[model samples]
Target: MVTANKKKIGLLMVLPAIILFIIMTIYPFAYMIYASFTDLDLSKANTGKIIGLRNYLDIFKDQLAISSIEFTALMVLIAVPVEMVLGLALSYLIRNLIGEKILRALFLIPMMVPAAVGGFGWKMLFNFIFGPVNYFLNLFGIQSIEWFGRPGSARIAVLIVEIWQWAPFVFLILYAALQALPRDILDAGKVDGAGGWKLFLHIELPLLRPIFYVTLLLRVIDVLRTFDIVYMTTYGGPGSATSTWSFYAYKVTVSYGWNIGYGSALCVILIIVSAILINTLTKVLNIGRELGLSKE
Candidate 1:
């Protein structure tokens, strides 16, 4: 009876938090799912009529949606690998440095900066008139390049800013993992003829695999949900060149039009895509083991 009462008490203590989670997260998600199946216009807030799967079907035919998905994919493909490689290299270099701790802290400054500030800073730096980038180009007799005024340049600018802001996060995670590595195993490798590139490729890389997968999974989700930078810098401008899926959904619902139902559908699609990609990556990496899920 005492054990049963103790269990009941424990359950009672957790019940409030569970209720709050249902209220805050589960309820909104359920509502959004319901709204996606209806013509829920903000203008006519309460008069939505069910439309079945029409919104889902229409999403494929929407050109901007297609473009946004394509652009987002391109950014993920380009940015994630570059960040991972750079982060790993930097961690390796810094690991052997005298001031590794201070340098690591300094590297985190960019990641600590607010996204709005970082985006605006990059935007100003890339400006054509009186911007440092253009001034530097002028010194070499090259004309000023309109970074955000052209579609291709705008995409490049966004990618550069994103890579700058996020690479440090990847570095921090990988660096911590590197530090936690078994020195005995590494020393053993060195004794056997593994040092430099051979040591890293054969020993370090394998140990770092789990952390790398975790970083990749996180970066992929973050890239897909990229918004503030695009909003503050490109606004998906220069003719939809930098429009990510999140920004496209914003344009559909709040900015360009007030199609709440369609926007909800877009959000649902985004959630589904993110979940699918994360699930695939988790399986490929066997992340459950890394996370200690297999232990229990």
Candidate 2:
């Protein structure tokens, strides 16, 4: 009876936050769904007559929307895998080092740096006329290239900036997982003459499976929503090359015009995609029960 009363009190304590979430997140999302099916525009104070599924259908046909989706997919595919692999390797290297603590702190510097600042720094680094990147290229007798002025180069630039900023997060997570492995199994492997590749393949990699999958899912989800670095560096340009869905959504709401309905539609699509990703990941991890328990 006492436990039940305590639980009820705890639930009551969190009721305000739950109400705020409903107001802020749930209400806005519900409004977006309603607005998406209308001809809502800012000039009309975001009021409009119902238009059915026209906006959604129009979204499918929009070249900019399609391009943004493709770019977002490519970014996730490229950045997440590369970062996970690199971070895992870095984690392994640092795990047994003499000054691992200090080294881990140093590695987190990239993540600590502000996103806009990091983007601008990379922008300068990739500049054609005066950047050191071009200077280095010249040393190799290669022509100076305008990195962000070209579509392919712009994509690469954004990818690099993203990888630079977020790789440490992957490293930290994987390193923690690695550190938590059973020492007994590792010792047994050593006794069985397992030195490097064989030991990792047979033992460590298998143990790291859950962490790898979780990290992959998280990074993929995050990369899908990438905006700030790309925004600061490219502004979704050199002809919409670096535009992800988030940037495209921003353009719809703010830059191109204030088509609130269209922006709301785009946001709805993003939310759907994110929901699907999260659901798929949760199914794969089978952590739903554990997550529920943690909430208690």
**What TM-score fits each model?**
0.93, 0.89
Clash numbers, per candidate: 0, 0
**Candidate 2 TM-score, true structure as reference:** 0.89
Clashing pairs in 2: none
Q: What residue pairs clash in candidate 1, if any at all?
A: none
Q: Mind giving the per-residue lDDT tens digits that candidate 2 earns over 53-169?
A: 888899999999999999998987899889998899998889778998999999999999999889889999998899999999999999998899999989998998899899999
After superposing candidate 1, which stretches have Cα over 4 Å from the reference? 288-296
With candidate 2 superimposed using the best TM-score fit, by how many Å does residue 160's alpha carbon deviate from the native?
A: 0.8
Q: Residue 204, candidate 2: how far off, in angstroms?
A: 0.8
